[model samples]
Structure formats: C-alpha cells, structure tokens
Target: MAEEPRDYEALMALYQAEKRRREAAEQNALEEKRGREAAEQKLRPTNLPEFLDACHIHLHASLIVQKNPTMSTQGNPDNAKNKLRPERLERWEDFAKHQMAIWDDIMASDFASKRQFAPLSALEQSGKDLRQQKIGSEIDLHIFQRDTVDKRVSSIIESMYYNKELREKFNLLGTVNFENHANMLSPESQLEEGMEQLTVHQKGKQAKEKQPSGSTDTAGSSHPRADQFCHRTAAFIVEYKAPHKLQLTHINNGLDEIELEDIVQDVVQRKVDDKDDVRRLVAAVITQAFSYMVNLGVEHGCVCTGEAYIFLRVGEDPRTVYYYLSVPEGDVTDTTGWTAGLEGPNRLHLTAVGQMPARPSTPSCGQAEKRHQSSDEESGPDPDTPSRQQSLSQPLSRTQKTTRGSSSGRGHHGERYHQIDRPTFLALMRRQLADDLDTDCDPVGRPGAIGVLFRVRLRSHGYVVAAKGTPAWFIQRLRWEASIYERLRPIQGIYVPVHLGNIDLETRYHYEGICELVHMMFLSFGGNLIGQHLTAENKTLVSEQVKRSADAIHGLRVLHKDLMPRNILWNEETKHVMVIDFERAEVEPISAKRTWKTPTGNSVKQGQTGPSACTKEIRRAMTELNALTIVIRL
Candidate 1:
C-alpha cells in the first residue's frame, strides 16, 4: 500500500510539470501572433508627418534634446559671426501670419500624402531603448556634448532623406558637411596639379584613384560660412550653433527691436566684441545665416541651436531676409485650442514639422514651348498643330519660371541641350556638383541596389541629370557603362542621354549597414520608363519604338543583353524611344559570328560582310526586342 501511494505522487508531479510547459508555450505563440499583427497594422499607408508622429521619431528626438540639455560654454575664438554682413535684414511682423495662411492653403488643397515608413521606422528605433529609462547617468558615464548635437541633427536629416516617400514629397536630397568635406567637383586651384580622371577600369589601378579635394571656397569670398550644406547648389543650407554658444535668450530677442545699421556697422567696425552681449550674438548669427543664403543664391535656410530653430527665407530681392524663431519646448503642445486653426496672434504654430510660408513657383517647360512657337512661326502652322496642343500642354502645366540662376554665368540648358555658351555651361557644371546626391523624383533603384538612379536637377539653371550612383567598390561596373555610352555616341541625344562625366563623391549614404554610395556618373535625364505607360492604344507604337532603338544599338556592333520593358523609355513629347542600362552589354569583334532567333523559331546567323550582314546583325539583336514587342501583341 505504501509503495502504491509513492508511485501515484510521482506521476501527478510529472503531469503538472508537463502542463505548465505547454501553457507557457501557448502564451508565447499568442504574444508572437499579436506582435506580427501589430507590425502589419503599422505598415498601413500614411503621410510623412503622420507616420513620423506615430513612430515617435520626433518624440524620441525631443527626448534626445531633453536628456542632453544645453550647457553654457566659452564662445568660439574666431568671433566669425560678428563679421557677417547681409545686404539687408528684417523680421516682418506678419511673417508668422503668412506662414499660417500657407499651411491652411496646403491643408485645404487636394494634397496627396506619401506612404508610410513603418519598416524603416522600426529599423531606426531598433537597438535603442524606447522605454523612458537610462536618461540620467553619471557625467563620466553619459558623455552628452556638442558631438551629440551633431549626431542628433545629422541622424534626423539623414533619416528623413532615406525615406523614399519623404524624398519624393519634399523634393529633398541629403545633406553635406561643407566644413569638413570638399565639393566633388572643385576649381583647378582646389585640386592637385595634373589630377586627371582615374582609369577606373584598369585592374590594380584603383589604388591610384584621386581622393576628393579638401575644403576650398570661391576666391575673394565675403559671405558667412555655414557648417552644413543641404541640397546641391546650397539652395537650402543649415547652420548649427551649439546651445552652449547660442542660448534661448539670444534667439528670443526680436531682431525688429535692433537697428540694422547698429548691428552691421558694429560688426564691420569690430565694436561688437562682447561675447556676453545676448542681442549682439543673436544678430551676428542671423546675419551669418543671411550672408550664406545670399551668397549661395538660396531663399531658404535654418539656424539651429539644438533647443531653438530659426527659419529664414530671402525675399524676391535676394538681399532682404525674413526670420521666424521657433522653440519646440514652448511652442508645441499635445492639446489643440479652439482657435488653433484660426489665423490670429493666438493661433498655434506647428514648427516641428518644418512647414514654411509659400514662396515663388518652380521650373517649368517654357523652353520647350518657345521651341514649338518658333517652329510654328518658321514653318507655318499645320492643321495638326492644334491637335498636338493638348499633348504639348501636358508637360507644360507648370507655368512658373524657375528662380534658380547662376551668378557666374548667363544660365544653363535643361535636360535637352539648347545652343548655349560652352564656357558658361562648363562653369555651371563645376559649381553645381556637391558632396551628396539626391533625387527630386522617385528613385529608379531600390534601397539595396548596386547602382541607384537619381534624377538630379542643377540648382543654378535647373538642368536635370540622370545621376547613376554606386559605392566605390562597384566602380568597375560604372566604367563599363561609361564605355558602352561612348560606343553609342552617335545616338547621344536621339536615343540616349549625353554622358556628362563622373566623379567620386566622398559622402556616404547609409542604410541597414549594407553599403555606401561613393561615386556618381552624370548623364542627361532619359524620359520615364515605357513599361509604366503601356496602354492598349500605344502598345503597338511602344513596340515599334523599342525595335528602332535596338536596331540603333545593334548597328554599333554592340549587344544589349538586357532589352526588357524596364530598360526601354519613351519620351511622349518628343515621340522618341531610348534604351538604357548598358551594364550587361557586350561588344563584338568584326569577325565574330552573330546569331539570333526569328519569329518562326528559326536560328539565323549573320554574314561575315556586306549590307546583308548588317541586316542580319539587326535580326540577331531583335531577338530580345521580339519579347518586348510581344508584350503589346498579348
């Protein structure tokens, strides 16, 4: 009886242990399922601002600011800010009201919000503790200082640019540290003597590739210099003054109260020597930002002190600048008051979202319109010209002329070259190339692509370039593509983009710790992808165009191995087709045998010589084009 009792107790204990294990496993599976569901829910489409709000990136940014509060420190030894002189400076009383009106207009319009960046946000938030902990530590443990400020600002800006949705919506690229890095294309004096383009294709010669030039500005430059330069041509630059150097009191003081002459003459006469003068310090920093904006020919700029953001915009007269100071800690709030949306003194300003008051319009196709009118005037109006008006009107919807002009020269031609001064064009090219590259439109390549294509517009003259950027390690592919472009030189503007040149951009684009872009090859913008616009009506036309483009490539004794729909482009206005991405192309020798498959599934080989051989060579190249053409047939 005693032995039986002991056996029963042992069995019961084993059963209880197994039941507990099963229960724990069930709970874990349920939690994981819920987690997956939450992630999926977050991935639903949203706008940039809304998505940012949900992800709490801006909140975390605020936390970073709170944790690393600004500390007082000694001013810079250079006293450089005092020397800044702008042609004119003014703080319009109606600036904030004007900005609010623009916001209202934007909100009332049929504005399309960009898609969500949930995955990206999750990745960005990973490895960092989200829970409100670990904020306070010993000074020896947590080293929050000036560097932390740079990292935070840089991180936020970089993260914004990385989001393809945000980039497309805002038409922004990445930022460049002009203080530390050189412009990719510098003046002759800025570069080493006899520094020529690297023979990148030559094996083992990669080691000799020219490193980028050090920091150098224009000669006789008299403008205030900023640390960070954003967007090519410095259209939108940002100046970061450490909070220790620039405080809230300085920013809070209205520039309207101080006389422009008092500030400018003081700086010029070297009378504003007191580093402790709060009003003088504020004036100096604003003047500094204004000078950079004027010299860069940009209208928009920002002066950040980590705790404060001062948004500046130059007026129609480049000399006159307007400033709006925003302190997020004091300005922004969770609650929305009854008069929140109203345009009044008590109206709320959501400055954290980086919304600016309306400005002048953007670039349009006026040149194209001019050409059409000239042809009409020269050749007389055709009956079909009226019919073609609607088609022409599509690309010319934006009527406002671009404010972007070069101080160095007349101006630049856009994607399509017009007869212009070659010397002027060359000068503009050297001036426009920056350390970082970003597209104003959608990127053709995915995040992890070896070669990403960006449609970059020149800031000076709005000349668009199809910039193909890749990491330095992938320089060989770029070299190969460049050679292929050279071989297709005869069809430069007709069937392909004009090869501008190549440069090694020292700035690195980071994403998921994968790779960084270090080199950029500039070419003219080929039109949109043909595959995207395939309609029942234009299918046959598209097919024929692709075939013609392929024939042109084949005539050069080159085989474009990849001739899919994605590789083909159609310019609707020009009625011209273009083929790109010659990375997989192969050049054949004169004696090499050329073969292609016919529509009847028969193998055909080209002759060794004569016009018949040329005809047969095209047939071989058309093998791939057959598949592209068949897309329309189906």
Candidate 2:
C-alpha cells in the first residue's frame, strides 16, 4: 500500500507531544504575570522617601518595553537589553531635589510674619524706658502692663500666656505701644475731665437728697401692747383693743394692776391698716412670748381666741375649756357617744357647791340596787294582766308570718345570737393567739384596747392566771383586726401586735361595750399611739406606704375602703409602714357589675371600674380618714 501509509501512528504521537509542551509554556507565562500584579498591589512604604521611590519604580514597571521583531524570532541576546540613558537619571535626581525645595518653601510660608508684633514691641520698650526715666510718674506700672497684655494681645497668645506671670509680662512688652510721646493725652486735661464727672455726680446726689420723702406715719399714736394670761378653767383669753390702749392688767384684790404695756409698740407703729397691723402686732407678741415661755421651760396648755380654741393636754380633760367651749351640741354628742356608758349624765351627777370639791355619784346605782332587792316582791298575777296578755298574745298575721319565715330561711337569721362554744371555739381561740403573736407589740401600750390580758394553764400545775372579762365585741373586733395585720404583714418592717386574751361574751354587749372600751383606751393614752394621729410629713409617708400596699394587694381593682390611722402601723426602725383593716375591702372588677348603697338609700354601681377606680377609692378613703381624725381632734 502507498509506502505502508508512512507510519501514521508514530506521526500522530509526535504531534501530540509538541502540543503538550506549548500549552505548559503558556500556563507558566500567565502565572508569572499574575505574581507580578499581586506583588505590586500589596506593596507598602514606611517613610516618605521610600514611598516616592516605590512610586517611581511602579511607574517604570507599568511602562511596556516593546519587543524588537527585526532581530531573531528564536533568540536575540544583543537586542534583549535596553536601558535608560545616564542623563535621564541625572534629570530625575534634579526633579526630586526641586520637589523637596518646593515642599520646604510651602512649610515656611505657613508661619505668620514677625511684623505683627514689631510695632507692639517698640511701644513696650519705649514704655519701659519712660517708666525707668520716671517721665510719666502718675502712670501705674503694674496697671499699664496688665491692661496692655490682657486687652491687646491675640486670644491664642493670651491663652498660651495664662497663669504664667513672666510670660504675660513678656507678651505685654511685645503688644503695648508707649513710645509715641507726642500722641499721648496731657495729664492735666485728663484730671480736668475726671473732676467734671465727679462734680456732675455730686450735683445729682444733692438733687436726690433735696427731693421730698414719700413716707408718712399713718399710725398717729398706735402702739403695740402684748400680755399673756392663764385660766384655771383651760379657757383662752382673747383681748381686743386699740394697740395703744392695750395693757396687761392683773386682777388682784379686785383691783387692776398694770403688769405690762406697749409690748409691741414698734410693730403697731408700722403704717398698716388697723386690722392687719393689729394682727401683725398680736402675732409678733405671741411668737415672742411663746419663745420666751419655751426658753423659760413653761409649757403652753392651750391657745384660744373668742371664736377658736386649741388644746394641748395629754389626755381628755373635761376641765379643759377646749373640750367644751363653743362646740355644737350634735358634734359633741357624736364625739362623746363612745363614753356614754362609762361617765354619761345618766350614770353620774355633779352638783355645784360653794368652794367644795364636786364629787361624782351614780344616780342609777341606788335605783339598780332597789330593783335587785325587790325581785321577790312581784309574785301575784292580776286579772288585768291576763286580759292584757290575751291581746298581746294574738296570732301573727299571714303576711307577717310569711315575712318572718322568709327572713329565717336566709343564713343570717339568728346568726348574731349564736354562741361560739365548742371545739371550733378552741380553734378560734388558737387563731386569735397566733394573731396576737404575729402582731408587733407596742412599747407605750396597746393603742385601741382597754387592756390586753390572758390566762395560761399548765397541765400539771393549777390555773396560772386569769384576767378581767374582756367584751365579746372587743374580742371579735380583735379577730377582724388580726386579719388586717395579716394582710399587711408583707410590708417590710411594719409591726402591729395583736395582744389580748379570750373574750367573755356572757358579761359583755356586742357593739356598745367594745366601742366604749376602745374609746377609753384611746383617751387614756392621750390618743391612738398605733399611728392613729399623724402630722403632715408622716401623712405623706403613710400615703406612699399605702399606695405600695394597695399595689401589692391585687393587680388593680382591689381597694381598702377604710384607710384610717388606726389601720396603719409604722415601724420607725425599718422606715417602713403598712395598711391594716380590710373588713371593708371590695374588689372592683373591670366591668361595673356590683351595686352599693348611697347614704340616701339609693343603689348605685361602681362607675368606670378599673385600675383607676382602685386608685380613686384609696384616695377617697385616705381623705375621709383624715377628715374624721381632724373632726375627732385626735
């Protein structure tokens, strides 16, 4: 065949080997180019000269050195290398030097010129020369230097010279001009101008002095008179008179002796209206006298005028006029109702006798004794009694019977009269004991109780002790009171101690007996010592504590309807307080679904019940409690 096909397989192998060699060379060239680019991108210079050198090197490297095709395609050793001329290198060195020189000139031009301070320095030197020669003898050297620097120097130099006395003096020497002797004002002319100003000032002052005064003495002869008097009946003596004629007169031997007069003369002499002047004079006199009395260790028992009275006694004292004077009959009745059973007019009588001590005697005691002794005398039944009993014993009407039956159907029927005597009684007693233990003990005494006493019995020993029978209502009240303390126990450091014994219902009425006992205890202690009476500052503290307590009770709508002083306990050591007495607490839900009776007997729902309702209720309770405390004079 056609020369054995010329060994086609071997020829193909040779062609493939050549192709592989060419592809490897192209890849190598591309890798070399990429390496150069990466090196240039990452280059960094540490100094200015180094950075400039790097920039020159990069610029030259970026320039393309074109290949010479006229030489040989394979290799041309002689034409491969072409270098820059020696003159061009020399020219680049000169360009760099010129650039450096230009930079130096720019830096030099940035600095301010020295001519700005040249004139100032000349003036300062001339001033120094004049001062040395004593040419301007009247000029103050210290003042001139200070004014020249402070007023004339640039702010930059002033700040730099601050707090440096020598530097400031040097700056002044540089800034002030005192060498222009011909331009200075004459000392005689300056003195003449100053004299003219002084003369004008003096004339104005004289004119002002000659002007008539507008003041006049409106109080022609009024003078202040102040006096203090004490009454055995605790009455306040309010004296009203023209200040000039007012005097303190002592009634000894039925004759007046002037003890003090014109005590407040200066105050009364002030040009004021008669009412206002009198008030001021009286206030001054009272304040002064009060201070004097305090200094002398004399306590004021009462303060009173014809229309008002204030008592400062430790306890309820009938002899104190503040207790009785000008009080409305109804108010008095309401205030003193709690004491009715103990010392009311029905129980005790007082007759006025000449200078003799008025002794209290119970009018009902004799009548009670007579009734006790005559119990056996009434034994016979009369025919008139039988006839009267027949009418009284008539059968109840159908409607009345139905009403009575319906009332008994409810759980409250006869509940008040139910006796609490059983195993449950012991449980209740234990609960009461636990409550007493939980309460904080009062140092002075229990605030709202007649007395707190109990009896303890040991198993092996005889009865240890016993106390007087406490009223049933009082004990029930103590139970309610204990619940309040429990609710308030979470308040930090609030301590309210419930300390009392078991109540004896056999010998006590429910309501009146307990109320009287509480009233008596309060009276005995001068006031409720368990935070029933609080000052303005203490009231604020209590109000804040109550707010916190209310917040802690429920998220919002729960309110403590009764926020009285007796219900608030303060712990001084802990600086904390708590609210007690939740007997009147009611939950005001988000919806107005509850009804309450108004004082007028109309039913009304809690309006707009929400968190706001709770806050409002608390505020209202606080206000009502405050008003009640004030009315009771606690």
Best TM-score goes to which candidate? 1
TM-scores vs. true structure, each candidate: 0.38, 0.23
Counting only residues 3 or more apart in sequence or on different chains, how many pairs clash (N, Cα, C under 3 Å) in candidate 2?
7
Off by over 4 Å in 2: 1-543, 553-558, 589-604, 620-634
Task: List, residue by residue over 13-70, the lDDT tens digit for candidate 2.
Answer: 7888888888888889888888876554344212212222222222111212112323
- Superposed by TM-score, candidate 2 places the C-alpha of residue 342 at a distance from the truth, in angstroms, of 42
The number of the candidate with the highest lDDT is: 1
What is candidate 2's CA lDDT for residue 144? 31
| Candidate lDDT values, in order | 0.47, 0.28
Candidate 1: residue 629 Cα off by (Å): 29
Which stretches of candidate 1 lie above 4 Å from their native place?
1-36, 55-84, 108-120, 123-234, 253-256, 264-276, 316-319, 333-351, 356-634
Cα misplacement distance, residue 189 of candidate 1 (Å): 11
